[model samples]
Each structure stands twice: as structure tokens, then as C-alpha cells.
Target: MSVKRHAFVTEENSISCSQTEQTTVQKTETGSKFTCQQCGRSFAAKGNLKVHMRVHTGERPYSCAQCGTSFTRKGSLNAHMRTHPGESPYICKLCEKSFSRKESLKAHMRRHAGVKPFTCVQCGNNFTRKESLKYHMRIHTREKRFKCRQCGTSFSDKNHLKDHVMTHAGETPFMCDHCGKTCSNKANLEIHRRIHTGEKPFTCPQCGKSFTAKGNLQTHIRIHTGEKPYTCARCEKSFTYQRDLKRHDSDPFNCALCNKNFLLPTHLRIHLRRHAYARPYFCSLCGKSFRWLGSLKWHQKVCICAKTLLPEF
Candidate 1:
């Protein structure tokens, strides 16, 4: 009897080799053919082939004892059990990061410097994980499937809803070992520790400005890149930063020359420099002048532009 083999396409598009040998059954004087109803694929044994049929049908009959993750076959269940033991045979060549699954190691290697190969077809946004792509789909659908148990706040993603629920519960699970300070998220706690440790991990490539958080560093990059995402509602003036937008929106005083309004007195004073002329104090030497007497005195002492004759203080 010839031994039959099976194959399965994994998440990475690689074919998984068959683990078990196929058993053929005899019917009457000849051989009996058994077919899997789900995938329309034929098999030898009803039991051994039943597991193989689950692979094509995307069915997970066997479940994990720890995490309750279901698998198509017992071999897959055995392979998943290694995840609970934290034993990863796959290692990335770029970053030297170990992953429980070979597919995970491939994804982790992309984050070494910066690489986003998988892009969304709908929005053209790139993401490292396929799960991220799934979550991003909800943004287009405007689907709020996950709801917070506390305040009934609905979010499209479960993680976002979980974050929202934390605010209502006031649950600060991440506590600093150095200090008693607590934070709702572990990443936020890690960023907040920089205040005590004086650590700035995120630095701008354009300017030498440093920030504790990557988001702040991204915003700082826009200052040099001149990428304005914020805009004013009243005047429709765009600004690179939110603080600039707020200042532009809240300005009370308007410039007489350009007719532009500014939030601070210093900003208005700087704008006045472009239009201002007629230096009142005149030089006794060349008739050169300045707007302020202090400027005239400095010019007169230097003997460069003009000398303003001062009477008495």
C-alpha cells in the first residue's frame, strides 16, 4: 500500500509537512474511498483523515488546556502548547528577538529599524500585524462593537474599549517599583518614568530635540518637516502644532499692517517690525534715526548709523 501525504498552508504561505502516515481501508475485495464533506477532499481513514479535513475546513476541534485556543489537529495543539511553556525555536536575524511562532518572528524583524510591508487596501495605511489591519477596518465601517462595562462608552476595537473602561474604573495596574506612582497602561508608566530617571529615548533627526515619548518626538519632527495637521475653525488657518492652533484661534489683537491677529503681545510686537518706519531721534552726524531712543543711543555710541544727541536723563 502506498502511503498518502497531506499538506497545509500556514499564515506565512509556507506548506506544513504531514506528521502522520495515511491508513487505507479495504471494501469488499477492493479499496474503499473516504471523502471529507467540508472540503470535498478524499482521505483513507475516517478518524485520522477527519483531523486532516479540519485543516481545509478551517475547523478547530481540539482546544488548548491553558488559553482555550482551538486547533485543527492534535499536532497543532501540541505545537501551541509550546507557547504556554514560552519556548520559541524561531529567532530573527535582524533584531535577535525570539518569537513563539515562526510567523511572529517574521513580523518582529520588521520593527528592528522601521518596516511596514503589509498595507491596508482600503486606506493604504501600513501595519506590521494582520490583527491591526482587522482593527483598522472598523474605522471605515464606523463600527463600535466593543462597549465599556462601566460608562457604556463604545469603541470599535476591544483594546480601545478596554482602555476606556480603565478610566472609569480608575484601575492603575502598572505601578512603579522605584516610586509609588501608578499608571493605567504599562507603556504610559514606562514613559512617565523618564521624569524621574531623566531619560529621553526618542530624539529628533532634524533638530537635536529629545522627548520621552515617541508621539512627542513625532510631533517635534513635524516642526522641522513643516507638516501641519492642526487647523483653526474660525479663520481656517493651519498650524503644525495644536498649541499654535489654540493661539491662532484665541488671538484678541490684530496686526494693523497684515491684519493678522496674534495671541501674545510679543508676537504682535514682532509683526510690527515689518511695517514700522520713521526713527524719531535723528543723528547729528548723518541724520540716521531709530524707532526707540535706546536704539538711537546704542547707534550713536557705536558711531555706525547715526548719533542722537541726548540732553539729560
Candidate 2:
């Protein structure tokens, strides 16, 4: 009886066979006839191998017509199409939260189950999803693959780069209904809406203080934890906030008339307005002027003179 041997090329760019007992040959077992030339991954069918080759080639044949998002597989593009029509077939029983895909619902279930399968070997941090672990690994690797063409700024996440790109174009699609204020992104607009609604969802357990945003809550927690992550390079002084460290490194903005020093340029500009007696803000009802907009708003609230004046058309 004669035995047939399978051969494949490896990372070293050398051809090796199963007779030589190479690791590449081990993967070619279980009757996987079709193999990927670039990654040495074996597949059962020729069509499967051809589809797998798209990973190395970065070829996304399946594209979304609604959002222009490209996917390697047809199934992935089909799953993405549900998002456009707000079709969420998968729903969590615990929280009643809906997801477009089954895999997303499965990952969300892990949070309820307290199951973290993916873990970083370097930091020992566990994540429920594989994609989350992949993004977290970039912190240790310092690999920022996504770069902005407009400002040359690099981001670890593609979504963050997408948000940063909008700043360059001055795109403020998300607007607040209360104050007519506009925000660059939907998340920022949601946070800005909390100010009008007086909603503080993130609460500090230690101090019992509440914050509108998660980032602000995290910063508030550092006050109790004494975690000063930002440090000044010049004086080696640490601060809880990056803005404080920047102020420590920067020269003080001095007032020419009073010789007073301010940490920020905006503070100095406001102080200069005091020296110049500049009252830019004025009340339309009473025709009363004030140095600051806050003062003008406060005076308008208590100003009974508006009652005596006739209404303007």
C-alpha cells in the first residue's frame, strides 16, 4: 500500500511535507484538501478556501447600500442590513435590550452571566468579547493603525477616528432641542441633553455624587482613589486631570494693566474685559447690559422693569 503525502509552504517561505512532520502539515489534516497560500490555513472546500483568502487580501465584495460599509462575507452584510431598518430580532430576556445580530446578544448575555472568556496575557484583564480584547491589546502594543488624513492624528479605534474626522468638516448633525446647541456626535448630544433634563445616571458610590457622563464619573472617582495619571515633565508634579498638567507646563497669562497672572488664556481674556469695562451681553426686555452672560441671565430673571415696558414686535 502507498501513502499519499500533503505539502505546504510555511512562514519561512520554504516548502515542507507531512513526511517531514512540519507544524503546517498538522493543520492540513482531517481531509482539508484546499489550503490558503498566504496564511497556511486549510479548508475542506475550494470555495471556502477562496472566501477565507479575502481576510489576507482585504477584499470586501459585499457592501451595504445604506451606509457603504463593506463586509467580507455575504452573511455579515445581511446581518448589517438589519441595523438600517432598526430591526432587532435578538432580545435579551434579562434587560430587554435588543441586538441586530445573535452574536451580539450572546456577548451581552455574558455580561449578565459574569462570564469573561477573553483575557489579555500581558495585563490579565478579562473581556466578554474577542473584539474588545483585540482593541485592549493595542494599549500594550501602542499600535495605532488608524490615522487621520486631515490632522495627522492617530486613533487606536476606527470609530474614534470616524468621530475625529467629523471635527475637521465642522459637522454637527446632533442638535439639542432645549437650548438649540449642536454637538459633533450623537453621544455628545445625549450627554448635553442631560444638563437640560437634570439627569445624572452615573453616581459615585463613595461620595454619593452624581455625574452626567461616565468619563466625568471616572474622573471623580480618582479624587477618592488618589490616582494621578497625568504628570508634568518639567517639575515631575502629578495631577488628576490632563488640563491641570498642561497648566503646570504652560506659562501664566499675565494682565498688562493689573499685573495679575492667570493659568488659562480664557481667564486672562475675561479679566481684561473687566479692565476695559466691556459689557457684551445685554437683556432684550429691559435693555440692561452686563459683563458676563451669566450675570445678564440672572438679572433678567429678577428684573421687574420688563413688566412696565411694552412688548416688542
As a TM-score, model 2 comes out at 0.44
Winning model by TM-score: 2
lDDT of 1 at 283: 69
Which pairs clash in model 2?
Answer: none
Query: What is candidate 2's local distance difference test score?
Result: 0.74
* Each model's lDDT: 0.65, 0.74
Q: How many residue pairs clash in each candidate at the backbone level? A: 1, 0
The alpha-carbon deviation from the true structure for residue 224 of candidate 1, after best TM-score superposition, in angstroms, is 2.9
Q: Which residues of candidate 1, in runs, are more than 4 Å off? A: 1-90, 100-161, 233-236, 250-313
Tens-digit lDDT string for candidate 1 (1-313): 2234232211222233345444332212124445444333344554666565444444668899898867657886887777664567787786666667878876787677578877877546577888767775664455788865446678886756655545554555668888889875667889989999999988887778889999799777766767665645555566677676667678967786676888789878766865886467776776776777787777777974333444445
TM-score of each: 0.42, 0.44
In candidate 2, position 246 carries an lDDT of: 62
Q: Write the per-residue lDDT of candidate 2 for residues 46-110, one digit (tens) a residue.
A: 56766765655557799999888777689978977887656888989999888987999999999
For model 2, what is the alpha-carbon lDDT of residue 178? 95
With a 3 Å backbone cut-off (N, CA, C), the pairs that clash in candidate 1 are 279-290
